[model samples]
Target chain A: MLQALRDTLPANRWIRLVLLAIVLGVIFTPWLFDGTRALDTAARLSIFVVLAASYDLLLGFTGVVSFAHALFFGIGAYAVAIAFDHFAPGFGVLLVAIVAGLGVSLLVAFIMGLVSLRVKTIFYAMITLAVASAATVLVSQLYHLTGGEDGLTYRIPKVLTPAFKLLDDKVFGVRVNGKLMNFYLVVFSSIVLFLIMVRIVASPFGRVLKALRENDFRAQAIGYNTLAYRTTATLLSAAFATLAGVLMALWLRYTGPESVLSLDIMIDVLLMVVIGGMGTLYGAIIGATVLMLAQSYLQGLMGNAQDVIGGVPILSELMAPDRWLLWLGLLFIASVYFFPQGVVGRFSGPAPKEATT
Target chain B: MTTRVEPIQATGGEPVKQHRAWWHRPDAQAAVLVPALALLALPLTGDFSAWLTLTLAGLAMGMMLFIMTSGFTLVFGLMDVLNFGHGAFISLGAFFGFTVLAGLESWRLVDSLWLNLLAFGLAAVAAMIACGLLSWAFERVLVRRVYGNHLMQILITMGGLIVAEQLIYVFWGGEDWPMLKPAAFQGGLQWGDLVFEKYRLLAVVLGLVLFAALMAVFKWTRLGLLIRAGVENREMVESFGYNVRRLFVLVFMAGSALAAMGGVMWGLYDEVITAHLGQSIMITVFIVAIIGGLGSIEGCFIAALMVGLLSNYVGFLAPKLALVSTIGLLVVVLMWRPQGLVPATQGGQ
Candidate 1:
């Protein structure tokens, strides 16, 4: 069946293998390690895969540099938070939050595109950066609505809460509970979203986006309404990002400015795409998994480093958990310098569709 | 590429002077725009003294912004490389300045005015030299490799920034340090009913001096001429056997030094220094840089002042809406003049 599915798809066998690995990884996560911790990582990883792919839709395919992506993501998180705050926490509330988040994000993306598309690329980036910062400040200041710096904490749907334990029997040394069901909910939705992103990028519209990315001037000359296409891509990307944000808020049971709307999150998305492979949709999954995993484990490494650096005061100081960002930052620069096209590009080379005429 | 020099007339003929409208000259228009806006805002504030104080505060803030952004504008003009990590220099300068001031704590406590000035000058000088040397290394190691690629420049510079910010943590730890002003520079001066913060007055005076000095160098000095010529046509300057590359590196160094000075001044202004100080203030610097034609020094100055004034006024009027108003200003300005208040030689492209 796997071979037949691979044969039906345009992608090579490697994609099939990766997809199989992902499926196996998701199914066996509870058995592979301490159930909650590993499952938590898997869920977070899945959410990031969706988030990163949506970012690639803009940065990779559309060639527009936006610093306001967090705005949409924040809106999604806030939508869920606000909905929970106002309405009873039920499945219906979740659906409403998702729709509201997607609707608002799409509108914002459209308006941002319409205004910024008039200027040059760098100018557009500046406008977005300015807007993002202003939005961030606005979010923090609206204390009554956003809970100010404390952020918003709200209840998840009763069915998804661990207190409603699903199974009495222990499954693979882990208690089968509502939390496990919620984990599967996030994982499965993320998979569906990821597949949708892949399908979108594989479509003809995606090809036009790649063309625009390579050289928009030529794309415009060739009769493509480049601006319209780009705006559409931005809206699509924002919708997916909003979905990811909703899933995150649902999983974490809280949403805040730092988590949802910070510039760092936007940069993290950029880094994921760049490191994974800008034009490759699959790279988003790979980049997110690698970076997220590393981030999770780096804290452990930092704790142990003080012991290893024993006598050297400076080295011990540098090895502190707070200083881990220094290494990550240096790693980011080294990766960009060494792998300009990113890890995926190194293996796949340039996608044939983006070849210059 | 063609040099449009007029041919000498055999008969002592004079070239016709084209009479154009006054506003047609961008320089004339920009010269009037900033002060005109300030004058326009006067009626909004009913109290003259309060209005004057706010305007002066804004001007002082604008001068500090200009000090930081001028170097950024210059680097962009000479080499079309956008250094997103320019804030790293600012942060490093502040940190280094902090160290120098901390060391001179005894000097700061002295009753003598000269001793206080000495402490401040030493710290500023120390910070500048440290930042200049570090920036030289930064340019040689990272910036040189990604010259023409805007995407890579942004990526690498941002990476550089992240690394620098983290390094600050490694050195200084994750704590916000308070930087005290010299005793002489701490208090406000009272003249009858009006009072002006001594540091703000100092900042305004120093900023004007720096602007004047920059203008003088660009207008009269041989090095300045070379730099201007090189910015216009690098190939032409190269053909004339001038090492334009070296000149640009020197300019980058000088720009970094200037940023260091701005950092020291900014630290004094804010009274608190953090690892992320540079990154935080970079938003305003970028706005100023963008609104002041990206590569135009004079335009940068005007834009910085305007932003400073607008921010102060808005903050006073509605603190919650200050950033919103500033963003609104940026959008309006860009919609009206896409290139900025004074368009640079390269423009936004």
Candidate 2:
């Protein structure tokens, strides 16, 4: 039966369809196992998928390596909190949050772009990194606005109840509450954003951006305003990242320094893009899924083995939630050493060779 | 030992005819006066508290900046490959140092300052070797395939950074390690009304010594000459039959070692070592190096000092505006002098 199933799904399209089905099955399997945790993981991974795709717009398409992408993400989350605090609370709050987040991100992008546009490649990367770090410090110091380290939390408003009305109350056709509603909301947003990213990448603007990446000087010589293209790409990328952040804040119902803005998030996005393969929309999703799932599973396994080791309990520490960074670092090193093409790129034929000369 | 070679004249004979002392040259004056003034004034100007605090802080921070940028600048200066993983090396160094120190502590050697120092040294060495081997592996497996390609190098090195950070989390755990000051260097020094931490003062002294030693190596050593030549023209150096690839690795290792040394000092000064330290500070170091000019060691030093002073002073004034200062400086510098504060020598590029 397994051999026949495998034979039936031999084609790439068939395999993709089967994978999609399995993903959906897993997402909805909470009904069978009465475990909503897997659904929560998928929702979190979806946020990452969106974040990674946004990063790819700059890193892959426009050839701009931004170290401050997390700032935009943080800005998005903070925007949501600020918006919810000032305006009426509800699911409708997402609209104001997104606008505020994108607005801040755009302003940041413009300022950073103006500064960094003069320096290309490594220098630009440095400037962006400094800006990101500075933003973090600024946020932490501004006690009135950011609440310092404590961060701001919103009470999950009652308005979200109507959105979950479709659940309607059973086991096979069971009633799902706010958590499940939030999960579905995130999943739907991820799909919409993913589709929009696909549209953007397939557009003429993306081609021009890619051309700029291939050769900025050549593109300039050919009468393209490379700076404008790059700046636009950067702004757009930050906008998407901020949108993801807003979603994250709403889903988690909390916003903190650690929640959205961090070097960890930046590194994670970079890993997702590279591991998924650069210059591909689907690669971001694939990378995010692989990394998040691996981390989740590995942490579980490591957590369980803590008792087996006695002296120098590296395994127990490694299993700790905070230690996920160590695993991520190791994965990054291993990937660079062995699978440079990344998982998706490995099977998607030869990597698209960079033209830097 | 004091043999003097005739100064090479610029093409204009009239300018050469002027009886100006060599000390009048801008570069010569800068080289001699900058350090002299900094050294003399740092301990003299403010009250003991201010002077000692600023000087020690500057020194400690400057050394860390040096480590961060030296390798990055060298790699970019020589091969034009922007190794994003440079910061990862610093992060690794800090963790390595932490691990060694922790191990020593567990072994009931907590009171042994010398042992702690040895652990620090060993950690630095290990970090240098690890970075060198990693670079070699990177070059052999990935970089070699993308030779002369900046974008690919950026992406691949970035991937390397992510993997490294993840591995760090897996092995070391995510919490910040408590950085223990060696017992011998734990106390504060009282010089009149000013009080300075012994550890920070030590860092300052060590950094100056290292700076002098590195400068001496560059000016007086054969290896330095080869490095300079290699930076000038790798093809010509290869034509001269020197092993350029090996030289690249050696230069890279030296740079990584410098960064690792900085990382160790940073751990001591900051009193905390975390996995994020590398990525967090990596960008600022890049900014320093870039603002200092891509390949100039002297420029890196000057830029580092400026960055340290700016960051600290900014943090002091409008604490909320601390982050803005560096980014603001970078913007102004890039706008004013896109090549950096000091342009690379014509032949160097």
> Considering every candidate listed, which one attains the maximal DockQ?
1
Q: Which whole-number lDDT from 0 to 100 does residue A188 have in model 2?
A: 80
Scored by TM-score, the top model is: 1
Model 1 lDDT per residue over A21-125, tens place: 766787678777674678888888888888888988887787777788888888999999999988899988889888988998888788888887766666667
Shift in Å, residue B266, candidate 1: 0.6
lDDT per residue, candidate 1, B10-59, as tens digits? 67678756565767666567767778878877888778888889998999
Among the numbered candidates, top lDDT falls to 1
The reply for model 1, stretches above 4 Å from the true place, is A1-23, A349-357, B1-24, B233-241, B346-349
Question: What's the lDDT for residue A340 in model 1?
Answer: 60
lDDT of 2 by residue, A1-357 (tens): 344333222234643564475457546645644455676677788888889989988887887778888999999989988777667787577676687678878998898888666566665676777777778777777878887787887755553433545455654665666566667777788767866776777677878887987788888899988888888888889888988898788777778887788776787788888777666656686788877877678666655565455345665665565555556665665654456545554565445454452
Docking class of predicted structure 2: acceptable
